[model samples]
Target: MQLSENLSPPEGETIDPTSRLLAASERLMAEAARRFPIAGDPHSRAYWMEAMINQAPDYFFFKDRDSRFLLANRAVISDLYKETDLTGRTDFDLFPPELAQQFFEIEQEIMRSGEPMLDMEEKIPDGRGGLKCLLTSKLPMRNEQGEIVGIIGVARDITERKRQEQLHLGQAELLKMIAVGAPLKDVFTALIHLIEGQIADVTGSVLLLDPEENCLRHVAAPNLDPNCFTRIDGIPIGPAVGSCGTAMWRGEPVFVADIETDPLWEGYRDLAVPYGFRSCWSAPIHSYQGQVLGSLGLYGRTPGLPSTTCQKLLGMATHIAGIAIERKQAEDRIQFVAHHDVLTGLPNRSMLDERISSAIEAADDANGTIAVAFIDLDNFKLVNDSLGHHAGDELLKTVSRRMLDKLRPEDSLVRLGGDEFVVLLTGPRRRGEQLSVRLESIRKAIADPVLLEGHSVQVTCSMGVALYPGHGRNATELLANADLAMYRSKEIGRDALQFFTAEMASSAHEKLRYQEELRRAIAREEFVLHYQPQMDLKTGHIFAVEALIRWNHPERGLLMPGDFISFAEDTGLIGQIGDWTLRAACRQNKAWRDAGLPPVVVSVNVSARQFQEPEWVERVASALRKSGLEARYLELELTESVIMADVQQAVALMHRLEALGVHLAIDDFGTGYSSLSALKRFPVDRLKIDRSFVQDLPDDPDDAAIARAIISLAHTLQLKVIAEGVETREQLEFLRGAGCDEIQGYYLSKPVRAEGIETLLRIPNI
Candidate 1:
């Protein structure tokens, strides 16, 4: 087939009959041009030529070397000259001076080179105040003597084709910006310009829905007047609130053909008419889940509905705008979740450090002091332990809001995790009274009673203040010193604030010295484990032994766990100590087996910090494998508070440990506030009654009731119950009567050395 026979329309469009007619006319004209000056009367031949040229759809014309029109077809005469004859007219009379000069230069080039210029695209005025793209072909015309005289040109309008290409390209570029995580504002700006470029006499805008305010906020409107946008911005969406707002409210396209007459614009007509916005078309931008996110709007100077092409462009603009808005919102949500507390919506530790460092730098430049205050809710644990975590979370949120309301705008309040907050303030040095007054207001606000989960709750806080340059330099030191002062506040009274002094610094230095020594203790093998036996209440035989850590301080001599366990936890050194104790206990148990002693499951206490490690489960497996001890002979005891911190995570970790054949037990069970539903999910073998409950048991009615309740609950769940701190004979008798499976305390035997345990195991009965 010939090229013309194989011609197809643009993708997704039908073939235009006008295009086919132009093609056929061009072929006929080409042949007719070769056979010009036929054997006939000159006047008759000229009349036939003029008639055929006039019948052609495309613009056909002849121009002299100086770019003067010699003869023009009807299309050119009507379109360019308003049906006037062009026998002596020049291009300068038909086009703007610059455009005419351009045409003349191109024609002169074709005439000078004796070549043809075909299929060249040009942008020219369409006689109105708009542009039209055209594909033109020009050839150097020759007289009968074979000398060039003028040029003949044929031009076809390609405006629609170019517009479609530009729209597709613009869509691709906008998608690229979204894909590469460009800022939302830049993408919106480019999007508005892209739409305005394709459509004439219109301004574009993008408004994102603010769900909190229930209003449309302008995001991008590069071509719209700023003052006009400011007036219309933040308008609440309604059925008749103009194009963009109504489109968002209805979650569909809204077209107001005339701002003055459309009922949708009745209330907003003044806002539009004064700004020359006579018409508007808006489409709601929807998320992938089909929820409306915002709207993309176009405003025109004339009052009429948009053309078919303009409508298509608007649809594409909304789709692209939707993608960009959704992506940006998702990114913002992720960033917010990472830096803010879920319970109170306060900034978390990560943001706290950044803000503190910035505040410190500002203080240094101004030769001022930065106050770092550490705030700890005094009775938060008591409230949480009694009211459950849900109520606890509610109380925390209320307290956070109250404190925030009482603080200055320049001050920053941050949650450092679990009932602890840090406030950073900067001012001139030696403003202790001023700082104290401010902190007192915050303290009073937090102490106010609040209603949580329908229960009247009240709480107080302890605050510690430390200043820059005097307390210490940098965030770490300042925070540490402030923590020490907060501890002092708690020691002296429940609700109060304490400023860091040289005395506190001296105490911190001592603690720091001990921390350094503890680090060496781990490396030099200066730590030892002691085992306390748990005796079966029915048979009076040793069933298991609990492992306890004691720091063998070089300078201070041997120290019990009470003297150093909390210190280790506070310094974050408990993880390392816990790992060492695990391996050592496992090794000792296997050695006892090798020594022909009875096998007793060794119960090792897992600290909260150690239990929360990402690799904690793997660490347990490693300890068992490396020590040559069977997993069945090892029991990992975790406190109820540790397990209850994150119940789902604790449950999952417990299951994984159980899968490895290790026994699990909840230590100090009755002390932590875990819901029955959460507790039943634990795959534990036993629950240990806390020492506090067991210490005053049998005589103290409340303690006795708690102990009996725990034993019954454990038995109902098909698990064993163990009582620790049973020092009195009466307590042991009462526990045995209450159906306790095991008992461990000084009453059985105090925690003894490894050799001491061998002797006790041999005796079999405690």
Candidate 2:
């Protein structure tokens, strides 16, 4: 029978035939008839209807002809957790504006047609994520006179059932990862993500118990702050520890309703508050034998016990975590050997790559930088040769321990192979000076003595540093650059740290190519010498000339010493090049004398490498003998650094040159650390004051004083003091007044080719 046909009708008014009482218990139907007053007597009907629906769990409401809420139940008024009465209010007050308009139109249709609406599925916010399904039924309600007055509606919640279906489907997909033997970390990551998706306002994490360290280490926490994860990791399990730690320590599930005020959560309240986590529940993960392996925790933004759905899914995650944890523990020993160094117990290259990639991503997201340091022990091969392999192994272990002690707990040290390691400094790396300070500490730690086989062996390491996003965007480029820099440190001298730069990376290859080209230049004669005449004071005459080498590149024009000399010195090519220069300059001087030109001594500069050779004196004698130029017509000049380095050696070399009747002079004299006592013993005849002291001339008092001191010292020693780089009359007059024996600078003439020197030799002197 229809809803109005079974109910009584009033005498003066007919029932609204389209209106009907909805299906309910027999008692409810009778109560509705009395409350609706089918008999047209309605003193207590309104009160009964409001009181009844208020106790109903489902949403119930009645609206007037204008779509205003004439009455509402506890469920309707309590939406979004608001407790105010909704009487005489419109749907605009209870729902969003657009939703209210649509609801009004639907209710108006039912009221005008006087028809009952069966079950209609609608979705709305369950006051959480705004996505809950409900079954709504709308119908017209008549008054005691049987006249249609307004519309009444009832809604039943189906959110929990729908969420349950999604949860089960998601869990099924997550199980496949574990079935295929995915990595423990990957599986845990998937499991936590699935639980978070089904549960509203909650994030999940998985932690594994490291029995050796007696702490809980984070396995997966996709939503947690990375820095927070790092801080929370390695938390020890004990009484009143964090939720996860305490749960594992007690061997049971633990729930913290409010992190801010809960005594059990007091330890981590500060850490959780900043991340917007106010509630937490953790379940202990257990193996099949009932031994606790780890914990599965769920954290929510608001403080309270978790929902039924969150609690249920947390238990499911705990089971999955247990399976993976047990499997990983069983395979830990084999896996550790595969990923870590066998001798030093440090992470191997494969694990280093994994960790570096993760660190790089985190750093990029944080807008920070990380330094990858490649370290190699110096003379490590020597240890293996002199002491047995066992002794070398012991030394490696000792060095590894020392280096590890010098790093932060978050930093990773990986042994890439024998005598080589990489350190991932997972801290702020914006400043190079800060990294340099840290690297210095590590270097000093590695330099400490290591006792091996009853012998104390002092070891040192060379390290190269590369930064992320500056040196490289990824691990491979970073590692390659760092390795190149380390080799550069070894090239210059070992036992120091070098930060990687783009220039350092190309220097080695460029220098090698340059050395080869220099060798070819020696064979093919691409080098040409320019002569700068040294004037004799008190006489308009050119007494000597300094031969400067220049390179004529086939593509680029003339190249100066600043372009390739340092590379030549570093590669030991300067020795051969300097020898060639000496012989060439001697022959040119002899050619001038033979050509009926005034005889003049030509000085050739000596490099540190050429000066250290045992046959240096013999090489000089051969150059003069081959050219048939008398020794007095040739001068050999050494920079102050080369001469002052070994004072005794300098005196002997100078004495030998003097005994051969060849002139000797110190080039760039004032720039070096030369002692006055030592200078007196040297058999030098001339001191070429450095251009740095003469460029400013009399204007710069410091330079003037230095020039004066050198001139005075040279005169006291009975040696000639030649001031170079003089470019003005004031400078020339100043030097002449100070008793400078000679002047060689632009004030006379710029350095020129031998042809130009012909004119300069005939020109007026300063």
Candidate 3:
């Protein structure tokens, strides 16, 4: 049969056309081949087939029923044997012994099961010296009778895909650990292991930066000698330093692929060579604000560049380090503010209170004693008033510093408030004198002058020392007793120190009781007013009566002013008692007026407390109105102390009271602290010479001269003069000869009730 005739086209009308001729020729060949078979030489047929298969680009091969290669294309032959004969050779015979064995086992499995194996990984020899990883597929071949005869396989290289798959798996494991929120150390360790396991010949470390120490500390490392990493724990960051140090110093990533040759590691080469690390890559751990916090690094025994994945892992570690550093710093700041004072930078009141409480508990536990010394600076107000508050504040701050320096380190100094401080000393009473000496030293230290604004200002402090289990056993009692002692020190002339005593407590209790009794005495009408007639010395006529306070006690018949007046003044009870005296004296004088007795003026002494009351004027006016007495006949006697308390307020109050038609007299005029300036400023109608001046008037020349001078001064000021405590006739004669306006004393008559005064008034003149 003719090949061209058998390939002839089907019947066509136009046989002359080239297309029709070619088609007819093909159809004739096809008919001939179908009707008859042609015999050919084996070598020619094989040569033609081999040429056709070898011309293909893909690897092609045929295997016998026994799973041995019968024929392989040129591409396969070249891939498997480097252009050498691979036909009629099994995979085991063509490749390295082990790899070839694996391929044959796979082929045998495919043939025995009559199943095709697709995309199987196989290693083929490159014929140079190494092997190539490839993807091969084996398919079952069948004869015309549909029986499996051999296997046909095709292969394509997939070494790159397999490498990518392994890399992906390692990255997935790392990401899974990160996503689980593992501890920082564990995460870092896992990362190191991942790099050393998947990547080639690598060692790595993490270093945390210590800002206070100005150094980097190794925190984690894998595949490195412990001693090598430990020695690098506290390395200072600088230029031309090792890889981690340099990265931290520049706040950037540093790569040294050849550690032995890199200048950055010149001084640190010994550390690398012994541990077999030839390359290192370091990335600085930095905060969001761009502050370098730490570094993450990779070390390799061989010279190599870091993969992009490794750099990305380092960046993640840097972020975690930054967060940790910020959190730790924030916690430190919170703790500092909690325990420190903002203004003075000293331990604040909270710290003081805690220390005191602990000391108290300790003292109680050990049966030991603790002393709390309460100190108040004397004359602090004068400094504030004269020099200004700024100077006063400076003085206080200086004093605080000095006091702290004077105390023992174990002792505590606390500022209670303005001009007040407390010092706490805790220990056993092993040396009483030693403690006293220490305290005296402290007092002297504080008493030293402080220079402020180029002025040497001397400040002295009064201390009140209270001991635990002696003055008080608790904090409140100790503070109270200390405060009480401090007041006592002030009363006894400040710039002194006093220990809490039982006598002070007793006296305080008595004063408190007296105050309560005085309040009740005013309300219960137990208080009475006595009248002592004030006679006109020249006319010998009773012109007025001075009212005196007398306590008509239920137990003790009649109590003089000497018994309770001082106590009343001290407890601030004098105001209430004085108000009662004013009303009673006015009412009694009105009673006498109604009874046809002389309409003489009634002088009632006003206490300092009463005079200082804001409503003193109103009180006086109300008293006169209620008694129906004319204000002109009422005389209000003010002591020198009353006007001196607040001179301006006193002058204003006196003027207001005087404006109500009441006469104001300065009682005890020459015996008080009133300045001559204040005397002229006061609005008074008369000056009453104090009894001290008149008691020795006739005997003592000084007393007589003082009385005369007072009378002369009163006349010069256009004010009348009255001499009180005129007990002797000679004293009375002296005062009269001195031209004193009025006289009132025991000689005329002691202070008696209103009815008794009428009897004395009715007596005829001698």
Candidate 4:
């Protein structure tokens, strides 16, 4: 009530009115001034105090000694929406025990000492969300007897200022780390820790964008539920992807609160729900020139947008991250170019040399040997000149892949520029022959034909080997010796391999002369065919003849196949010679039939190299058509050793021959290893037992047993078996009793010229 209205004299005093009013107002105003001192009327102290408390920016509350609230200002009532009552409510009633205990202790101290606790920096709740940086002060509320009754604590909101300062400090430290060339992951780790410390109820992460995979890879994400990170490690970047991927895809920041309902978290809501994170925000890390490198993601358990401080921190971190990632990628590119071959991705000469040096030291320490092979592609220039350089490049790439596939994981094949490469074999010692076998496998792999530009281009490499301590004491010496050996291979003929030896250099001239003579022999057409007759044991009649090749050197008189066949194979001339032999044999057999000789099957030997040709079957068909001879009259004999190497291809080829009605025979059967199961797949008409089994057969039980088993096995398969080198009547009788179908050796006739075979064929049972 207004004092002026309440102070009227009862029933209107009859005395002087002005004097009476002056005395009454002076007395009431003096008592009001004692309680409230303001610029306005002194009697309205309660209104002034109430206005001040409600208008104050900071929270003002008074609590009793037991921390029970006695009075709260307007800010306290509005901020702590549910804590309105002042009669019975205490700090424990509003806050958790741990938080209320802190308040209780401060209030107790203030009341006991009758002093004020001022400007205490504390992390307290702002009554709305998360923790706040608060500068709280508590003062004792005392009565007139000097007994403390209650306490008042005022807390000013300083959350933004405190967090902003912390963010700035963290940014400086992180930048310093990046400037000092910290590893990308390490810098990311530091940034994660900085964010987790400054931002309340949040986790930090740095996800790198993989350009190749077009996804975000989790680089670092500490202080988070592992599922939120580990489960989404490589998320594809797209519109519907999670925060990190979406941010990178859009090249901007993405903020998602209430993840369950956000469209951006359509498929990923379950991932955050289980981990207790309800919100996610991501900002793309861009290169200085604006390329999206990766992203920085922040996740929080509370559903809300990022605070102002967090937003500022993410911006700076992404900028710094871009610079670091770019620097790292550039360094990696330089390192890769220096160490690897651009064409094959194999080690280059520099890396190979380094490895060789390290290998040498290790080998010397263990007193072991290391084989270093230098490989050079033969006739590579011809391929480049005839089929464009592009085709040549394709051929090289195919060969590189093949040779690489054949190497052991520990072995390294290094490109030494152009058509040359070096291979290093280290670790446990291997025999010289084993190393030779490995190198041979690589050469054979390279020899497979590669189809490029409609032409099947086949390549063969010449590999020269030099062993550590035996051929050279160092890498340079070893390489030089290997080069010398490679040159020796070229001097002998291309597509040949040799080991380093001092004597090879002196023999090189002699090898060159021999190569020249051999080349001339092929050009001069000085080769002849000899035929050996095989008589049927059941009828004692000659029905087949094996054609043998012999070289008639102009000055050397006559030369056996042993004298020139190896050289021919080494020079890659065996394919041509094999084709020639087939044509000659066909024509000769046809002529013999035209001459009224007894018809017989003409068998020709096919070498390993010739049989592997892509057109081998076509060549056979062409020969039959050209000579006008039936395929049934001709039999192609292949050694067991060659056919067994690649059983599948051999089976297919033999089946093709069967389709052509050409009889196929397995020659030297007892001398090779053939699995019974695989041998059954071959569509062969006969198995010619190698002569070695028959030469001393009847007397030697091992040979007799071998020959008997072969004949019995052939009969079981419904195949005819022939025993060669049956020079004696005893051997012939033994083979016949063993169920052999035929015999071919001196007992019948030696390998003679076609005319000589025709004479024997017309002699009936002779």
TM-score of each: 0.57, 0.37, 0.38, 0.46
Candidate 1, 270-325: lDDT as tens digits = 87899888999999999888999999999999999999988988888888888887
Between which residue pairs do clashes occur in model 1? Answer: none
> Which regions of candidate 4 deviate over 4 angstroms?
1-162, 210-216, 234-239, 248-252, 263-267, 286-293, 307-313, 357-368, 377-396, 427-433, 444-462, 473-477, 487-494, 503-766
What's the lDDT for residue 627 in model 2?
A: 92
In the range 634-697, model 2's lDDT, one tens digit per residue, is: 8888886788778788788778878888988888875554544466677778999888678878
Kindly list the per-residue Cα lDDT of model 3 for residues 611-717, writing each as its tens digit.
77788889899999999999999998888766877888888898898789999998877655565434667788899888866775787665675677667656755
Misplaced by over 4 Å in model 1 are: 1-88, 127-129, 142-147, 152-154, 177-186, 361-368, 378-386, 428-441, 444-449, 458-462, 488-497, 503-766
> Which residue pairs of candidate 2 clash?
3-21, 125-130
Clash number for each model? 0, 2, 17, 0
Model 3 lowest lDDT segment of ten: 334-343
The full ranking of all candidates by TM-score, starting with the best, is 1, 4, 3, 2
Model 2 bad stretches (over 4 Å): 1-506, 764-766
Give candidate 4's whole-model lDDT.
0.82
RMSD of each: 18.4, 30.7, 33.7, 32.6
Give candidate 1's error at residue 406 in angstroms: 3.4
- The digit string of per-residue lDDT tens for model 4 on 499-582 reads 999875565577578777877777788899999998999998999998899989989988999998887886778888888899
User: How large an RMSD does model 3 have?
Assistant: 33.7
